[model samples]
Target: MIALSRKHRTALAMIGFLCLMTGSGCDYRKEFQFSGPTMGTTYHITIKAPFWNSMTSLDRSIREELAAVNKSMSVYDKESEISRFNAIEDTRQSMEISERFAEVLSLSKQVWDLTEGAFDPTVFPLVRIWGFYTGNENGLPDEKTLEAIHHQVGFGYVRFDDRNHIGKCIPEISLDLGAIAKGYGVDQIAAVIRKAGYTDFLVEIGGEVVASGRKASDQPWRIGINYPDPAAPLDLVYKSLTLQNKAIATSGDYRNFRQIGGKRYAHIIDPRTGSPIDNGVVSVSVIADTCALADGLATGLMVMGHEKGIALVEGLPGTECLYLVKNAEGALQEFASSGFGKTP
Candidate 1:
């Protein structure tokens, strides 16, 4: 996945809402819109509700739900549940986790198994060694250091008992849930909106998004797919598609990376190799039933490369992907799954 710093994640697309005034033949509803900082990035929510008095209550509820998620999974929080688990060194001791943390872990395991371990949460050590976790760039680690740390990285080492809500790290592995947490946050906020009796809404955190029902204009939410061009001054939309009751996420290396000795190292690390991925794939966009699933799959597909990633998306249900790769002729080539809307 595209690496997001503690400050913010590179927004995948520019979001906008369309509003129409009330007229004789037009149907107009008051659109409640609000944005605020959360989870190291900004969150924007739009809801179509008949009553305008509930805005204050809805906003408070949204903030509280997001804070609850951060407390459960944020590594930057020293006292967070995941951080406390990382501090433990004993392999035999099991730690009890909250239901939210357990849910994220369970979803992560399913993607890990689906991608054959391509989407791994235990790659925090590798992320630090590559200087992604830290702002200071450390060129590259030696062969011995790489091999030793790689031995300690693997999702299989982390064991979880779903029935009892218990988790244990077999080899003292640290987890960086940067790739999947934002998506989970989006899902949580959507749930809060739905529970409050709002059926038409859009919830976006970082770049991951989940849309339900239609906008105030009675049109499906329109989302843009950004072109994966590093030379572009700003994000350029390659195509736009309508989405409802689903989630969309994009992972790309064009924006986040470090350069050393004429070699560029992307923020995304391949768990199987213990290094930054240099594959030709520049970006991957995934659409799924939930933002969390789309977010994890986008990163896993980026590591799997173009052909294999396309094949994997084809076999999965309720999922589609678009891959942008640089060919030998120095041109961008696009490969998309059968279900991915009109290809550009």
Candidate 2:
């Protein structure tokens, strides 16, 4: 069974209640908004079109697109494409996947290479061993266990082809797209909106967001980076930016972490170190042309820490990052790329 976090439930109660009352089609100042639960979270979409042929059909299409992505990548679903691939115990067996699955896996490989093994989809074993997957801390693993699990974690152990066939070199190797799948889901939802003859829109899944065109009022879509505090209100923003035809994704350990023996361990495990990131960095938000890229980069940056993360993001064209770090004095510090917040 899929277990929902308190944060997840709170998010659903906050947005799901409104969408439930509005029936997935709410009209506000010539903008139409719709939302629903998917991928263990909720998605909110706003279209600037003054009119559409059928709001119901458009809403259904958005949900269908999300379901398709969930069917392909959801690790919580035992029958999902990724889950089924994980169940394969023989190295000789290769699974033929859908085009969508291939696209996401390709992107995962790209991110893994870019981050120098920081953003690994094969870190599922580490995540589970660290207790973030089951939400039950079984005490920190011993050095021997960590070493064995770390050996199993790397994208290089997995093989994929241009024909959309994927296989693991060892049966113990598994994949998890939790870091990047939501952003891909956002992009897919945006495609559905665009296909339905809408241009100006905003699509948000979990915390990943994609903004296209401008609002009906002719203003750019404004998104706020939340303060990296578990106790902070959802609206407590550290910074806000106006985005037009861009995507932004934020990765932070503030909300998802386990405290072991008075020390906090983040959910984001470093595939390289085989441990939760203890770097002073608290949050990383990345902006790119696609939410998937932003999402993957954000998580990779978190594992890369502040200086290297900023340096890497600055070198990449058409990409920007903002990092929030905790200082030695226990204060929050902000580090951002030169082009960050210049979006308009």
Candidate 3:
């Protein structure tokens, strides 16, 4: 989940009740809530059912589904499909991949094209250069070093044959699916819940969320967007929306960042610049049909800034975005796409 500062946590607590309210009256539909750790964070799943059996079975199924996803995409796992592929040095041979991996790669390519390469997954080397990969905040790299590594990064270096589920990449190029994998995992868990005949549900991984059907109270699932102020408490909610059968993902520069000298470097690096973005836009929230798309787009919009991000979202169908920008005078300015404020 997006880590918030102490002040932001307090703000979040203040607004928590407004975002989700359980039905106080007795109802036939019972609510089940459970959570566990996954993907270096945690996941929360809530379901409303008229009749159910064995929470143990349900939890086991959910964990198994999520574990499969992690085994496919996690960079930290040396035995993961992606990590194993990264270890290969031959660019001439095409490698077979799991269906899930192929699906994510295809979607990532679409996002790469849509955002004009602002959302490339092949920039992991740049991430490492900035010390984001190891959590060590080293100073910036020299121009020559950046240029040399720049040759090794680019989505164009990757080729995917969807018909055969095969992937090919230049020897030096590798992928990091950190941005979209968690959201995809959330969607997969939501699928598991729906398959079990439960439609009224909410699945959240870290901060990425997907809401299905409605609450037992017949109210739409409500989600709160955190304020884009690092100094604010995590409980501080800038806006709240009711959504059903949709997914929401947010990307912000406030939480994950490194401070060097008088300047701060956000975790999100601009693939185009081969460096961390210093754009005025502080946070981006995207609502889409799938959490994976929302997660990828949110990161893309943050790199694109306000004007182009708004334009890109407006042209797309079944999508909306909210942009929070820190202005010159330190005031936060809000901008939303045409459909962002509409009732779902």
Candidate number with greatest lDDT = 2
- Candidate 2: segments with Cα more than 4 A from true spot: 1-29
Tens digits of per-residue lDDT for model 3 on 173-197?
8888988899899989998998777
Candidate 2 per-residue lDDT over residues 303-330, each given as its tens digit: 9998898899888988999999998888
Worst 10 residues of 1 by lDDT: 10-19
The collision pairs in model 1 are none
Q: What is the C-alpha lDDT of each candidate?
A: 0.84, 0.89, 0.87
Which residue pairs does candidate 2 place in steric collision? none
Evaluated against the true structure, the overall lDDT of model 2 is: 0.89
Residue range with the least summed lDDT across 10 consecutive positions in model 3: 19-28
lDDT of 3: 0.87
- Candidate 1 lDDT over 189-238, as tens digits, reads 99998888788999989878998999988888888878777777545887
